[model samples]
Target chain A: MAFDAFQKRKERQLLWLLLPALVPLLILTIYPALYAVYLSMTNEALTGVAAAKPRFVGAANYLRLFSDGRFWNSLFVTFVFVVGSAIIGQFVLGFISAMALRRKIVGAPVFGAAILLPNAAPEVVAGFMWISMLAGGDHATLSKILVFFGLPYVDWLQTFPLFMVVMVNTWRGIGTAMILLTAGLAAVPAEVYEAARMDGANPRQMFMRITLPLMAPTIFLYMLISTVSTISVFGLVYALTRGGPGNKTEVISVYIYNQSFAAFQIGYGAAGAVVALVVSLALGIAYVRSLKVEV
Target chain B: MAGISEKRSGAYTLLAYVTLIVISIFCVLPFVWMALASIDSNVQLFLKWPDSVTFDHYTKVFAEENGVRWFANSLFTVLSATFIVMVVAGLGGYALSRSKAWWKQPFLYAILLIRVLPSTALLVPLYKILLTANNGIGTVLRPLVGEHYRFVMQLFGFIDGYLGLIIVLATGQLPLALWIMKVFFDGVPKDYEEAAILDGATLVQRIRRVLIPLALPGLAAAGLFAFMSAWGDFLLPLILLSSPELQTLPIGLFRAFLRVNEIDYGLLAALATIYLIPAVIAFSFARRFLVQTFSGGVKG
Candidate 1:
């Protein structure tokens, strides 16, 4: 009876302890999310009459969203951004960096530090830095480099806004992918490689047969985390392009921001937000179920 | 492993070095330009060797602009948010690690799911909620303080105030910090707490005396991450603070860039360099904890 009483008391204490975190989350994250759904169904505006008296329009905003070409363009841009940066660019470059670092090479730490530096850069700084690197017609860094090699200067951002955005996003994330994949690489036992070598397997064959299969779980985790994060990337792309040169670089987050604030269409933006939220939540659920996380 | 030919191995090692050098250059090139531009007297958009290295641009940021205010604002809000995250996550994480209640598992899953919900999606409604709270607080404060209303509201109001930004930033970071501290506390044996309890120590006493000392590393990890993330945040400050007095470094740098007619490359780079320093310092310190946190995040 006493033990039961002690256990009960402890739990009550814990509930009190949890209240500080719980309250803000309830008001800010949970409430706002639910409110987003409610707000999406209404003809809400940031200012003017709709702000004063929001009216429920049911599926009207969503119908409008389904037909919107810019909305479709943003989705396509986001898909390309996630896949191009997180899946392809960062992964390949990071994996190569990781692999090279494992070879008992000289100056490995310097290489590692140099690569990780970009991850530490704030999005705004990274965007501003890239503008200097890309925007200065004849005086841009890339143009200067091209001139040194006697090649024509290409107006990078204006000519290929989406690609430049992807590359910059890729640059920011390569460090994260490298660090995670490095941990994954370390976990694959040296004994496996030794056994493969005994069978006269080349490095390529050994990696395909041994490393790739062994690192599947880590790779999957990296993919899920990176994809979700890359989708959420805003300040970098926003500061870089502002979804412009004709909305060519508009990812979903920027799209939502532009629709809501720039266009003053809160209800319309919320509908797009709902779509993003659902997509992310679905992926998150899959991640949880797949990992069957220990917590 | 010795079954491999030595000649082939040499080539591969050389290839590895070449790859590393190239990738490292690609990664660090932009930063190099930013640094050089900050010091270059004749700085332009492109990378170039300085004809005469100068400190004038950096001084211009402080003497001519609001560099000090921007830096202080960024530091103050981010630090306050980090502190709140540490304290809240510390207590809540202990509860999570030790408790076997039914709510534990559901709560855990909810926070993990919360991690994936992008902040942009919630911005509109979040704005609405803050607006309502701001009005409520304004109503309550306007009559009480009379003439000092605006000043007090700037400090305490929910919409364009210090308190609102600090609380919201901390909350956005809570899920990860909670996970971090929970995982950390799980590894900590409960014997010290048990002993403290047997000595008739109250919960608060036990936490202050026993748990805090043991949870320092966990707290450091949580705090570092919270600081880095909150420091780097742009959207929250952008939407939250409209007043020039409240501008953070990111906004200040952004605004400096937005002066289309009078663009000063040197000063902008200096501002960026100043902004970049703290993040780099924090990141370097946080480096050792990265592998553990990322793997712990998923494995937990």
Candidate 2:
């Protein structure tokens, strides 16, 4: 009975400890999220009559959003961005880098440092840095290099907005992918590799049969993180293209921002944001389910 | 047979080295070019190699543009947010780690779920809340403070101030910080605290003397991450703090790009370089701890 009373007291203390974190989270995260749902059903705006007196439209914004071609375009762009940058580019290059770093090569630290350095720059800073390199003109770094090679200088960003954005995001994200995959690589036991070698398994076969299967959970976790975060990437893409050159690079986040802040349609933007939320929640559930299966 | 295998292994090693070098160059080339552009004059930017380097662009960042103010604003907001996250996450993490409550598992999962939710989804509603608070607080304070109404209103204002941004950032980072700290706290043995309790050490005393010192590295790692996220953030500050005087580094750099007529490549490059310095320095200092945090997170 005395021990039970002590346990109850301890539970109360734990609740008290949680208050500091929970209060801010409730206000900042939970409240905003619930409010977003409410806002999505109204005809709110930052200006005009809608700003002065927003009325409940009851899914009108969502209905309009479903019909909007630009909304569809943003979703398509987001799909390509997530796949090109996070799934394919970062994973492939990052896995290779992780595998390379695992080897006892000369200058391995220097190579690791170089790969890690790009992540140090903030998104907008990295975006501007790339703008200098891939900016549309004869004077840009890529153009200058092409000119030196006796080739015509091409405006990279203008000619290929989505591709350039994807490439830049991949560059910024490879370090994170490499770090996570390296941890995964380390967890695979050396004795397993030795056994495979003794069984006359070639390197490629060993990797396919052993390392890839072992690293599946970690890879899924990385994908879950990178995909969700990449979907919300705003500053980098915005700073680079501003969803311009005819909205060719308007990912969902940018589309929402343009609608809310640029077009001043808060309700419409909230509806778009709701769609983004649902997509992310769906992706999160899928990844979590895969993780459970892997475990 | 051994000789043939050795020759093939040598070729494989050569291939690995070549690949590593090429990837490293691909990663580093943009920063090198940006640095070069920062030091070059407009005319020199077009040249293959500049004849001379100049600090003209660097000077212009401070002289014409208010770079110092933006840097200070960023420093203040990030540091304040980091401090809040450390305090809140530290307490909560200790509870989650040490407690045996049945609710802890579900609560922890909820926190993780909150972390995965895209922050952009909350932007519109957050904007509305801030706007409401701005008007509501003004009306509430007008009668209470009377003569000192503006000062009091600004203090409570959420729309365009440091307080709102700090709160939002701290909340956004709390989950990761809490998780990292919890992992560290779990690593610490219970024997020390048990012994302390036997000697009649108070809860605060046990925490301060025993738990904190052991978890210092974890705390530092979490604090560094929180600081970086806050410092590097563009969206929250962009929408929340609308005043020119309140601009952070990312916002400042963006404005410079937008506002400048000729798109002064040299000046923009210099500003970006300046913005990159603190993050690089922080990463270099905390690289080991940060990596350990990631590994710990993944293993769990």
Best by DockQ: 1
Model 1 C-alpha lDDT per residue in residues A1-295, reported as the tens digit of each score: 9999989998999999998988998999999999999989999998899988999999999999999999999999999999999999999999999988999898889999999999999999999999989997878888888999999998999998999999998899888889999999999999999999888899999889998999999899889888887888899999998998998999999999999988889999999999999998998888778768787
DockQ of each: 0.72, 0.57
The reply for model 2, stretches above 4 Å from the true place, is A289-295, B42-48, B143-156, B290-300
Q: What are the Cα lDDT values of the candidates?
A: 0.92, 0.83
lDDT of 1 by residue, B1-300 (tens): 454488788889999999999989989999999999999999978888898999999999999999999999999999999999999999999989999999999999998888888899999999999999999999999999999998999899888899899999999999889999999999999999999988999988999999999999999999998899999999999999988998899999999899999999999999999999999999999888888777545311
Best by TM-score: 1
Candidate 2 residue lDDT tens string, A1-295: 9989978987798789889998888877889888888899999998999998999999899999999999999999999999999999888988999998887799898998898888788889888888878875997877888998999988889898999999999898788788888888999999999999898887889889999999988887888778877888888898899997898999999999999999999999999998988887777666555555210
User: Least accurate stretch of 10 residues (summed lDDT) in model 2 chain A?
Assistant: A286-295
- The CA lDDT at A243 in model 1 is 93
* Candidate 2 clashing pairs, residues 3+ apart or interchain: none
